[model samples]
Target: MHVVMTSAGIGRIEDGAVAVLDAPYPDPNTVIETTGSLDALGGAKVVRRIPLDGDELDLRAPLGRPRALWGVGLNYHSKAERTGRPAPDEPVLYLAGSSSVSAPGAAVRLPAEETVQMDYEAEIAVVIGRTLDRAAESEAWSAVAAITAANDMTARDVMKRTGTPALAKSFPGFTPLGASLLARDAIADPDAIGVRSWVGDERRQDSSSADMIFAIPELLARISRYAALRPGDVVLTGTPAGTGQDRDDFLRPGDTVRIEVDGVLPLTTHVRA
Candidate 1:
């Protein structure tokens, strides 16, 4: 079953009545309201079935709101090699602002205060289904409910010059995520999915989860050791080797970025000053 948390409400796709699972923290509330039973609201009958029109409603983050936006850097072997960085023994993590979250089709702002080396990185974002701490690799799968495509837009100049990635990465409207959140069951193998990015009609990043230095399960296990993973928190799996910055090409105003991953919907947004 595919699920989405929109500005409208929490909805489960299928012939079912949409259950109101409280705004903002709907994932945990939905689980609690259903008493651990996904079908607790009665059945597919009770869910309010509404027609999905892409233009009618705005797609918020898969979760109405997330606690933190955690991202992995250089997890892809090819990406690490391109930047002359070693493949990390563990996930190289960073935090993007929760305020940076924007939906697909929205305009991503280029930070005028910063240098013009803005780049696009296509990644698979993991949406946590439940709160967990020190979770084992085998148990990590249970903690994730859905997956979506995310563009980890960055300002390479700010990152390299200031030596502070946070400044470059956390700009407002930097992360543009897609709408559809594919359920775990829909994705048979998370580590085998394909991810690709395109600038206009040109295909840029083409890679598979198989190339990840540290796979999703290991990343979840490693991250959970220190901080508690809460429901609705997003873990942005690293991007592949073909980022514009790596090629010394940067995004210009009016360019469109499209990211696609197998099992999830494609996300497209435009760049603007």
Candidate 2:
């Protein structure tokens, strides 16, 4: 099932059809609090069937307000090789707050004061389905509910200056997430999903999750040990090589970024003036 949250209401794609649920936006925390678990909402009753049109309604990020938006850096072998950095023994973790989250077709506001070198990182985002603490690699995938694609927008100059890239990456609307969330069974093998990105007409990043230095289970196991994972906590499985930085091409005002995960979702964001 392709779960979707929109201004119209909560909806899901069932049997190649879209059905709107008779409820407001399903916030992960609120759902868990009321229903005992996120899984309980999977069978929500369909109230209305609406005609499908991409431009008809406003699509919002599937997770209403993610508790923690975690991201990993240098997890791709090709990305590690390009920056002349060795694959870290563990995942290079970073945090992007909820404020950074944005919906598809939204505008990413450039940092006016410190807008030096902005870049786009196409990544696979995991949506946690349940609470997990110190979960083992064998049980990591069980904790995931859905998957989506994201663009981890960054201000390279701000990162270089503050020595913490999170400052650059967590700016308002920096994280553009897909509006649709594919169920865990949507993909037979999540580890090998395709990730691609484009800056207008130029394809900047094209790679596969198979190239990740640290796989999904490993990342979940490591991150869970340090931070208790809850439903709706997003984990960005690192971007592949060919980032704007590596290509010596950075985003400026009036630029558009489109990122896609072959079997999951695709999202686009525009840099505003």
Candidate 2 vs. true structure, TM-score: 0.92
lDDT tens digits, residue span 101-140, model 1:
7776789888777778999999998877767699998888
**Please, what are the lDDT tens digits per residue for candidate 2 over residues 154-179?**
88888888989689898889998885
RMSD (CA, Å), candidate 2 to true, equals 2.1
Model 1: weakest 10-residue lDDT segment is 33-42
Candidate 1: where are CA atoms >4 Å away? 5-8, 12-58
lDDT of the candidates, in the order given? 0.76, 0.81
| Per-residue lDDT of 107 in model 2 | 90
Best by lDDT: 2
